[model samples]
Target: MQLQELTGYGAAIVAGLVIGLAGGGGSILTVPIFVYLFRIEPVMATTYSLFVVGTTSLVGSVSHILRREVDFRSTATFAVPSFVSVFIARWFLVPAIPDPLLELDGFVLAKQDAILYFFAFVMLFAARGMIRSSEPKADKSAPAEPPRYGLLALDGLAVGLLTGTSGAGGGFLIVPMLVLLAKLPMHRAVATSMLIIAVNSFVGFLGDLHRNDLNWRFLLEFTLFSTGGILIGIYLAQFVAPMPLKRGFGWFVLVVAGYIIVQEILTSRSML
Candidate 1:
C-alpha cells in the first residue's frame, strides 16, 4: 500500500531474481534489504531473511528437481549436519548473546550493530568469490561419484555456522564445496545448494518463532513476490548472459558491503 512497503517487496523480488539467475547472490542481499529498506533490527532482519531465502530457494530447487539435477544422497549428507548446526546456532548461540555486545572505556557496541558488521564482513567474502569465480569446466570424463561423506559433513557444519550467524544461505560457499569436495557436477551442485539452503534457513527460522514476534503477513507477501521473480528470472535466463550479470552484481555487492561497514562505524561513533 505504502511506498516503503512496496520498495521492500520490490527488493525481495530482485533478491529472488538474483538467486534464480546467479544461484548464489540472492540470500546475500536479503538482510541488507530488511535492515536498510524495511528498517528492521539486525537480529530480526536475519530471522526474516531466513524465511525469505528459504522459501525462494525452495521454489528454485523444484525446477532443478524436475530437470533431474538434484542429488538426494549428497543432499542428505550435507544438509543433515547443516540443519543441526543452524538449529543450535539459532536456538542457542543467537539468543544467548547479550545486548550491548561489547563495551570498552568509551565505546558500547549494541548486539544488533555487531551482527550487522559481521554480516558485512561475510558479504565482502561472498562478493570477492563471486567476482573472481570462474565457471566450472564441464564434467566430461565420467559420472560424478559422490565425494567423501566426512568431508561433506565437515563443510556442512562450517557453512551452517556461517549461515546462522549472517542470516545468509552461503550458496557462494556451498556451490564450490559441492563441486570441489562433494564431486558433484556443477548443475547438480547448484541445485543441491538450493535444497540445503532451504532446509537450513527455514529450520533456523523455527528457532526464531519463540525468540521474536514476527510479522508473518509481511513475510508471506515478500516471499510471494520473490517466488514470482524467480519464475521471471528463469524465463529471462534464456536470453540474458549470466557472466556479465554476475560480475556486475558482484561489484554492486562490494559497494553495498562497503556502505554497511562505513554506516556501522558512523552509527557507533554517533551513539557515543
Candidate 2:
C-alpha cells in the first residue's frame, strides 16, 4: 500500500480506539479521515462513516447488552424515530441538495463545502462539550422515574436528521438526552447511546445504499482496523483515566475543526 493509505488505515484504528475509550467522536474523526486521507468525496465519506460507526457501535452495544446495561425502553423511544428520520435524510434530503448550495455576492458555497462546514460546526459543538466536561450526577438510590417519551422522540428526530446529514453517530447528543430526559444513570446512559447510535447509523447507511457504488472490500478492511482499535481502547480504558484523555481529545478535535474550515475556504477561493 502507498504510505498515505497505510497512514489512513492507522488513523482508522485510532478513531475506533477513541470511540472505545470515550464512547463518542468516531464520526468526527472517520468522516475527516475519509475525506482528507482516503481522498473520498465528502458526501460519500458521510455514507462510509455511517457504516464504520454503526458496525463498531453495534459491537460495543452487544457487549453492553450482555452486561444488561442497555435500557431497551429508552433505546426504542430514542432510536425508532431517529433511524427513520436518518433514512429519510439519506435517501431523499441529501440527494435533493443542489450542487452549489448557495450563491451570494461573489461567493459560492458548493455542496461539498457546505457539508464540510456543517460537519466542522458540529465538531465545534462536540468539542465544547468535551472541553467543559462534567459527568452528570445521577442518584442510583432514587426511585426510577419513567422517561419522557415525547421529548425523547422529538430529540431523536432532530439527532437523526443531524446524523443522516453528517454521518455522525450522535452519541454526544444522545448520551446527554438519555441521562437528563430518560433519567438513566451515567453508565447506563452511555451504554444506551451506543445502541441508539448503532441502529440509527446502520439504517442511515441503508438509505445511502441505492445511491452509491460502495467498495465493500476497502470498507471492510478499514473497519477491521477500527474494530481492532476499539479492542485496544477497551483494554487501555481499565488503566487510563478517561477525563484527561477526553479533554486532550477535545483540544485535538477543536484544531481539526479549525483546519477543516480554513482548508475548505482556501480550496473554495482557489476554485473561484
Candidate 3:
C-alpha cells in the first residue's frame, strides 16, 4: 500500500503495544496519529480514536480477564455514571457546541481548537501524575475496604466527561480513581480501566455515528493493526519493565502535549 497508510498501520501497532504493555496509554497516541500522520481533522480524528481505542482495549481487557486481573464488581460500579456521561457528552455536549465557541477582540476560539486544547490539557495532567508517581504503588499495609460506590460514581462521571469530550479512554483518570475510590490494587485498577474504556469509547463512538460519516475502511485496518500489536505486547509482557517504561512513556506524553498545544496556538494565530 501507500507509505502513509503503511505508517498509519505502524503507528497503530505502536499504540497497541503501549496499551497492551501499560494497560492504558495506547489511546493517547491515536488522535495524534490520525491528526499528524494521516492528516485527519481534529474533530474526526477524535471520533476515529474512540473506535480504535475502544476495540484495542477490548482485546487487551480480554487477556486481563483470562488472567483474572479484572475486578468485575468494581468495574460495574465505576462504569455506571461513566457510561451515562460519555454517551451524553458525545451525543449532546459535543454537537451542541457551536463553531467559534468564543470570540474576543482580535482573537477567536474555534470549536475544534477548544476540543484539542482540552485534550492537550488532559494529557499534561495525566503525564504529571505518571511522572510524579514513577510507579503505581498500592498501600498493601492495610486491607482495601469495599468500594465506596458514591465516590466511584462521581469519579466515573468526571472521567466520562473527559472521555466523551476528547474521544479518549481516559485510563489515566480511571486507573487512579479505581485505586483511590474503589480501593483496588494498582494492577487490578489498570486492568479494570481497560474494560471501562472499551465500554465508554464504544458508547462515545455511537454518538459520533449520528453526526459524522465514518471511513470504515481505514478504521478497521488501523484497529486490526492495533490488535496485532496488543498480541505482540502480550507476548512481550514477560520481558517488560514497568517503572522505567512508565517514566519514558510519561515523558513522551509530555512532549506530545506540548506539541499539540503549540501547534494549535500557532494555527489559531495565523487564522487571526
Query: What's model 1's TM-score?
Result: 0.93
Report the candidate with higher TM-score, 1 versus 2: 2
Residue-level lDDT tens digits of model 1 in 59-127? 988988998888888889999999899999998898898998998997888899889989999999988
Candidate 3 lDDT over 1-272, as tens digits, reads 87986888898998888777766777888888898889898889999999999999998889889999999988888888898999999888988999999988868898888888988888898788767654546567978677787988888899888888887888877877777778777777878888999998998898888765788998998999999997787677669875466668888999999999999988987877
- Each candidate's TM vs. the true structure? 0.93, 0.94, 0.93
lDDT per residue (tens digit) for residues 154-269 in model 2: 99999999999999888877877888899887678877887888899899999877865898999999989988887787678679776688788889989999999999988988
User: Candidate 3 — worst ten consecutive residues by lDDT sum?
Assistant: 130-139
Clashing pairs in 3: none
User: Candidate 3: lDDT of 6?
Assistant: 85
Off by over 4 Å in 3: 134-144
Which numbered prediction scores highest in lDDT against the true structure?
2
Off by over 4 Å in 2: 139-146
Q: Report the error of model 3 at residue 245, Å.
A: 1.1
RMSD of each candidate relative to the true structure:
2.0, 1.8, 1.8
